[model samples]
Target: MNLESPKVNVTKSPQEVFNFLEDIKNFKSLMPENISKFEVLDDDKFLFALKGMPEIVLKKKEVIPPNKIVLGAAGGKLDFSLIGNIVETADGNSEVQLEFAGDFNPMMAMMIKGPITKFIETLATNMPKAI
Candidate 1:
């Protein structure tokens, strides 16, 4: 399954946004308020639990400075990738886009689509505030 989040216009420059996202632990700031059992395992990984969901570990997978960052599930039941794309706007600010892709069976996709979509949308919408 593939999901795209709304573009967010942030006051930070592209490089600044990239720098923030390069640290996997920063993701905790973007998580929904109800998240519990959060832990920062290392500079490149973190674990958190969402309501009704199994604990999840997110790890940094790849980073292209000032452009993109990719994170994936680490030792979790879900196999998924979360990508952050940063573009420099003409006004010296940045526009960030978030995308999520998950590997799941047809039945599983049907079961989780709504929640996953909302999750990614929330992440994208709240990122600028987090930064």
Candidate 2:
């Protein structure tokens, strides 16, 4: 399954936004209010648990400076990835979009689509203030 957010503009420059995201600790500001727990495991990983879901381990998989950040699940229970795209605007501001992709059986996809969509959408919308 694949989900994507509408591109949104942020007042910050791409480099500034990228810098904030490069530091895993800054992710808490972008999490949903329902998140029950969030912790940075190290420079490239973080663990979080939502109200009714199991803890998910996310590892920073790839980075293309000032442009992209790729995060994916670890520990093998689920296979999913979250990609953040940042583009510099003519005015030096930034436009950001988020893509969420998961490999799951049809039944599993049906069960989690709603919550997953809400999660990524929330992140994208919160980006303007997250940095």
Candidate 3:
């Protein structure tokens, strides 16, 4: 299953946005106001817990300069990725979007899709504040 967030424009350039997101410690600014817990495990890893959800360890899986950052779940049995895609805009700003993808049993996908989509959308809307 896959869910994409609405693209959001930020005042910073793509490189700046990417630099901020590449740091695990900066993720807290992108999380919802209701975020219950957050911790930086290392340069490429962090742990966060949202209301009503299990604590999750997000480990950076790949980095593509100013374009993309791929993160995966570290401690859960679930197989998924949260991909941040960035593009330089005409106004010297950046356009950011988030994609959430997972391979799950159809039933399981159906069950959690709504919550996951909502989460990603919230994160995307908060993208302008990333830098």
TM-score of every model?
A: 0.95, 0.96, 0.95
lDDT of 3 by residue, 40-100 (tens): 9988999999988888999999999999999998878898999999999899999999999
Range of the 10 consecutive residues with the lowest summed lDDT in candidate 2 = 19-28
Q: Candidate 1 at 32: error in angstroms?
A: 0.6
What would you estimate as the lDDT of candidate 3?
0.91
lDDT of candidate 1 over 22-117, digit per residue (tens): 976778788887787789999899888888888888889999999999999998577999899999999999999999999899999999889888
Compared with the true structure, all predictions reach lDDT values of 0.89, 0.90, 0.91
Q: Please, what are the lDDT tens digits per residue for candidate 2 over residues 30-96? A: 9999999999999999999999998999999999989999999988679999998999999999999
Q: Would you list the rank order by TM-score, best first?
A: 2, 3, 1
Off by over 4 Å in 2: none
How big is the RMSD of model 3? Answer: 1.0
Where in model 1 is the C-alpha error above 4 Å? none
Q: Pick the candidate with the highest lDDT.
A: 3
Could you say which candidate leads in TM-score?
A: 2
lDDT of 1: 0.89
RMSD (Cα, Å) for all candidates, in order, is 1.0, 0.9, 1.0
